[model samples]
Target: MRLIIAIVSAISRGLGVIAALCLLSAVLSVSEMVFVRYVLGHSTIWQTEFTTYAIVAATFLGAPWVLIQRGHVNVDILQLAAGPRLRIAMEVLAALFSLLFVGLLAYAGWVHYEEAWSNNWTSETVWAVPLWMPLLPMPVGTIMLALQYVAEIMRLFVEPDAEDGASRNTLFSDTAEGTRP
Candidate 1:
């Protein structure tokens, strides 16, 4: 279980780095486009499409890393009020729910990718980029997110007493004042 979690974490971190690079590339591309269009008085073609796809890809690719890091926003008032057992139960339920939701999304995304790939679909733009290129990240990210959910569920069972700083501060502690532990 620990090995599985470690591997998943490593993969998520790698994807996160790729996502960051995608974002940087998008920014640079857009800047170049602007410079070419306005400064050089030239028309741009691919930058808009490339930047859009890059941003979307970055969002999907980075989601699993956010989940693994507990960076997603959560209103944890109920968690703060719950007892230890109830908290554990709630965490399990949340993880299960996330797994189900993300799993379904991953499945759907794969189906979409398959259809796009088989049909040889392309964007109706000047660039005519392959649809599968952008679609690939959706399933990949959601699958990683589902795995992260599994790891969360496993952790709840394996180390019930373990309290990470994010959970301790955001869920249980008073945010206005300071952390509990």
Candidate 2:
């Protein structure tokens, strides 16, 4: 279990770097499209669709790391006001819920990927994206998400403060102090 969690965390972090690059690529593509359309008076259909997929890829790829790092925004007003033990209990419940939800998503995505594979589906767009391309990311991302939550739950028990000072927590701290954008 420890080895598995370590591997998952490493892979999640690597994917996050890829996702960052994809996000930059997506931004550049959109900027190019805008320049072409507004300044050059023409835009390629592929550029728009490709950019959209890049953004999606970036989002999916980054999701695991975000979850691992506990970067999701949480409504903690009530939890914050509650006692430490209550807050810990709430976090555990939330992590369990996340695990269940992501487990379902991963299973569904696997089924979808299998069907797509059997049918040899492809995108209807002129660029012809293989259906597996999008579907592959779904299961991969959701599984990563589930693993991260599992790791978090484990950390809550085994390594308290593993999630302390997480990225979102920092953001929330800034917001609480009226220093956030």
Candidate 3:
């Protein structure tokens, strides 16, 4: 369990770095676009497409890191009244649901990738990037996210209350009263 948690932690950190790099790519691409349009009096064909791909990559790649950091938006109103045991249960259930959702998404993405591969899909642009290039990231990101969440659920079971500050919420509720069911 400890080994799994450590691996998850490492993967999460790696994703964070990748997300940062993606953001940098977006910024650079946008800057180049601006420079070309203003200074060169012409638009670069690849700037917008490259930036869009970077944005998508950053968004997906950052998910597991965001989960690890508890950085994603959340409503934690009900956490005040929740007991530790209840919190653990909720965490496990949430992780399970997340796994299912991402699992389905990854499966669908794999199918899409296969179709694109068979068709020899390529972007219809000056860049002409291969469609499979971006498609590959979807399942990879989803699997990483699923692994991180699974590790989180397992950590809850193996070492309950080991890291209090690691948890973002005790239950999934919009208000302070917490989840009733």
Candidate 4:
């Protein structure tokens, strides 16, 4: 169990790096597209499409990393107000619900990816990029997210006070004084 959790966390971090690369590539693609379209006075072909796909990939692929890091925005009014046991219960329920929804979403994404690959589907545009190239991230990333959820659940049961800084008895202790310019 410990080994599995470590592996999943490492994989999520690696995917985060991949997601950053996707964003970088998207930025570069857009820059090159602009140069070709305006500076060089030429029509663009694939850059726009590639940028869109890269961004989508980044969003899907980066999710697991976000989950592991607990870097997402939090609305902890209720959590802060709840008793310790209730707080854990709420978190478990939330994780379970998220796991179920993401599991179903991953399944749907897999079906779409399979269909695209099997049918040799391509974009209607002149570039005619294969649809599976973009669709693959949807299932792959969602599955990773599901695995992260499982690891989270395991960790929660094993160390009930670990998540969201609950061990410290406050989710946002450092930010107790609101940030303001």
Residue-level lDDT tens digits of model 2 in 1-181 = 5666778889899989988998899889888888989999985677787787788778877898997776887888987886445566788898898789889988998999999889999889888878887678788888888888877766655543443433333322334432334
Where does candidate 4 clash, by residue pair? none
- Cα lDDT of model 1 by residue, 1-181, tens digit: 7788788888999999999999999999999999999999999999999999999999989998998889987778997788655676777888888789899999999999999999999999999999999999999999998888887777665543555433422333344333334
User: How many clashes show up per model?
Assistant: 0, 0, 1, 0
For candidate 2, the C-alpha RMSD (Å) to the true structure equals 8.2
Question: Compared to the true structure, candidate 4 yields what TM-score?
Answer: 0.86
RMSD to true structure for each model, in Å: 6.0, 8.2, 6.1, 7.1
Runs in model 4 lying further than 4 Å from the true structure:
160-181
Tens-digit lDDT string for candidate 3 (6-120): 8987988898799889999999999989999999999689999989888888887888888888786666556435665465566677679878998898888889888888998
Cα TM-score of candidate 3? 0.84
- Model 4, 59-163: lDDT tens digits are 889999999888766677897788655666777788899899999999999999999999999999999999999999999999999999998877765543544
Off by over 4 Å in 1: 160-181
Considering every candidate listed, which one attains the maximal lDDT?
A: 4
- TM-scores, in order shown? 0.87, 0.78, 0.84, 0.86
